[model samples]
Target: MTVPGYRNVPAQEWDPAAPADPAEAEEFLRLCYTEVSRLGPVEPRLAVVRAQIAATGTYVHTTDELVWGARVAWRNASRCIGRLYWRSLTVLDRRRVHTADEIFRLLVRHLQVAGGGSAIRPVISIFAPARPGRPYARVWNEQLIRYAGYRTEEGVVGDPRYVPFTDAMRAMGWPGRGGPFDVLPIVVEVPGESPRLFELPEKAVVEVPIAHPELGWFERLGLRWHAVPAISNMRLRIGGVDYPLAPFNGWYMGTEIGARNLADPDRYNLLPVVAHGLGLDTSHEATLWRDRALVELNRAVLWSFHRAGMKISDHHTESERFLAHMRNEEKAGRPVPADWTWIVPPMSGGATPVFHRYYHEADQRPNFYLDSEAAALARGAGVRPALAAAPLAA
Candidate 1:
């Protein structure tokens, strides 16, 4: 969904059955108290949540806390380059939801709302949290919108990163049309059931077909990307509480699509293809073919999204905004934790402001995290095999 560091982090060994980390939970409550109290006394509500945490070893966030916590989580996401707009996140509280079907339905709405028309908005939908005895629901899509990867004799077709997950979906009985640009269906798994694949309604998805302003051949590559980058598989861990089904999105920074997704060898791997198309000298490492193609792909992504009237930002502008965000956080006496490798754009890193400075890498709480189990699930491993055949929800 989100790259681990992007939507992924190194897998931290954790027992799903273990109780909430008391110290972490307490710290989270303190944060909630401090933030919520700034609005009003709200001491009574805080007292109740505290008492519940004491009794049950867990507690529910009030509507205000959930909303604020989600926003704060974005602010605390170490790898996000778009933290400049953290406070603008729209939180949709669906913590009551536990079923695969309902989550699928809400995800459709999330896509429609976030990517509907050309109005790109940042939104997060928080679903049920993982507790001591209950298994949390999980979405298998690394992102809400992704192309299906089909394994062929010639090699993997489509996005290679998702080939395993795509196979897993097919094995689970999803009838996805195998094509290079086919939008993968959303697969949701509950603790006790088979993962269900829900097809995204076409109308809800807005895609930008890649085309270069000068290179006419670019459009013939048949490459297209979804306008919204809704990360669906990661957990939003706040105050020691784990919400495993919080799917959040922001508009893309052109480099993410152009440099990483489309150019990375493990992904669409289009650099060599584009370089060949451009008739570049690929004989030597110094030809800078990769660098040149990367720039063109990034250019095409920005142009395509712009032409389609979808929201997108160039790496240069995003990097500048991130610096402004850092200054603002400093003014507020908050240390912004950032991963320099991730904060800088994938292409032309040295040219961006973010690449010139060091950042605090200390992790902050109320941030999105990816666990080993969720990572495996995203790879298309069946839940029944992994969870000892937990009963499927009928």
Candidate 2:
């Protein structure tokens, strides 16, 4: 397939019947950002990468496995195509590998000079544990410094919600720390039809108060469409169940969404992102962006892996366990309502945290973080604007 902006790289073919590569197994990382860059400086090298990447089920083991090759491709392609027009230093002057976050820094710079609206979205997936921002972040980040055009030590930017330099962002931007990549937020639709269903599919997930007056009900659920339970004629209802689950049709990003996901919490927080603000007609020019969603989806898939490299992260909420306690409150019929607190899974107990560190090599050099978008935004943009329209808490 011709990926317009980029030359083709070797893509791997998959055998569904065969076992998956151990690296790509269990966890999946999306290297969406580096796809265009993977083509090499030479036409032939670009072809090799194009062929390798074209495969359907290529597995990503480390962040290196995911992005280095792609960055190398871009470095190689620089000889002829957009090189002369570029206003910055050449990547060949610097020889190093880059991490997803670093790539993002460069991507912002690329946009600053290239002036493309949103062609450069990248995602990464990490299958293990690693620190979010330490010196090592440089290892994967070095490659970025080479290709990214401008320079100014500006703290990680590209605020899709608010253009940092824009007077609008400075004058009326929320949280007011303009990012160059700001795009108006879009609001997706939430139907008023019957939403709660039972026997959710394997992908079905829910989030609820850890300490609610009415216990037993979970908070939120993020599952794949395939995971939804087979609804029967009887299962349908207006609302109100012990679990009080809400159905959503969207993404449960594994690890490919990358720095875009990180900048998110820094941008407007995570909840709003999950709500799909890209669709709000009054907010964003989403339709104009609709055509390339596949490319966006591809970026999302790849960026997820980069985000995963930060460190093992999770929602870490005490709300659910407290929900059971809250149930006891109502059972005793206590008039006083319980206050909320940050939820942390008890490590001593049998509870195994989703964000534990992963020792990638024999040296025990910790790499990757098991982060989820739900945790980053803390409650899908919180229980504010989207809540009133959203179903009331059970």
Candidate 3:
């Protein structure tokens, strides 16, 4: 059965060996400059870019160009329902740093900066772009913060979705605490170096303990989740250049945790547990026990986050905001590229405003993409064999 938002749509393959296309650079620059009038005309900038691409294989993006390009990349993210605030993304330029230790340090800072206060700001830290025919540094973790999953004798402990990944980390000498919510170490790999594991300090990770507003026993379940959903492995492509290690984040919508992460059968699979706790009859589907449990679980997630003073949005409110974003984009005479499967909320599809409309589907450039190889690595494929020969680095 095809999952609602987790469709296996293939991303357009990127050839790392190929030089940056001057035409793509021109197209992006023209749009970028045209949108922001204060940046002035694109003619002079285009001339320099063309000349540089002719001489060298690629042209460097100026700070202004990089900033605008990152924001536009967020704007062009088709799967994201929160693109209404794309312009408000905090772009951290980390193009100069390359070492694993420094990169790890900055990543911790990125989380603190993003989730330190109650207001979780949307942030992206763009690392060095992949030069032509050159390997670039990247984080192996799909998201910067995820709990470790351990497969034991009886069944899987913690999140079953990450069991393979957790096993791979253990193979690489990460002594994972066999606990439900142990934060997995960040594996950073630079060119010509072994992937090193860096444990996230307690201060770097902001977590909200899950508890229903009224269910007193819900706290005993000991469920919690990280605040920031920073996707670390997706390649951030912008203006003909690809930043393989640009980790970006936005505050989570309640349903993402309640309906998908915690409730998915393959993940935490909390529906049955919650239903049992609620004393609902699960002997028949006609009882609608799962639906009742899902609603209550989602309510708990939203309530917990709100009580913690963390920024979170409900699926209903976010759907309305997405429609507002589409209207705003329409006024600008721009097409809003979106996937119908993703734009609609996974839990209540018929109830949301975005569910009723068809959207333009386009592979717009200056966007983020999950390369197949990166996805494989994130899921713990090719890890044991690749790192088996190399000694674990500090």
Task: Give me the displacement of residue 346 in model 2, in angstroms.
Answer: 43
Clashes of each: 12, 89, 0
Off by over 4 Å in 3: 1-7, 385-394
**Residue 230 error, candidate 2, Å:** 35
TM-score of 1: 0.92
Tens digit of per-residue lDDT, candidate 2, span 106-130: 3333323221222222222111111
lDDT by residue (230-346, candidate 3, tens digit) is: 999999988898899999999999999999999999999999999999999999999999999999999999999999999999999999999999999999999988888888998
Instruction: Give the whole-model CA lDDT for all candidates, comma-separated.
Output: 0.83, 0.23, 0.91
Report the lDDT tens digits of candidate 1 across residue range 30-61: 77777667656555665776777778877787
Off by over 4 Å in 1: 1-11, 36-38, 42-46, 383-394
Cα miss at 17, model 3 (Å)? 0.4
Model 1 clash tally? 12
For model 2, the superposed segments whose C-alpha errors exceed 4 Å read 1-104, 110-371, 378-394
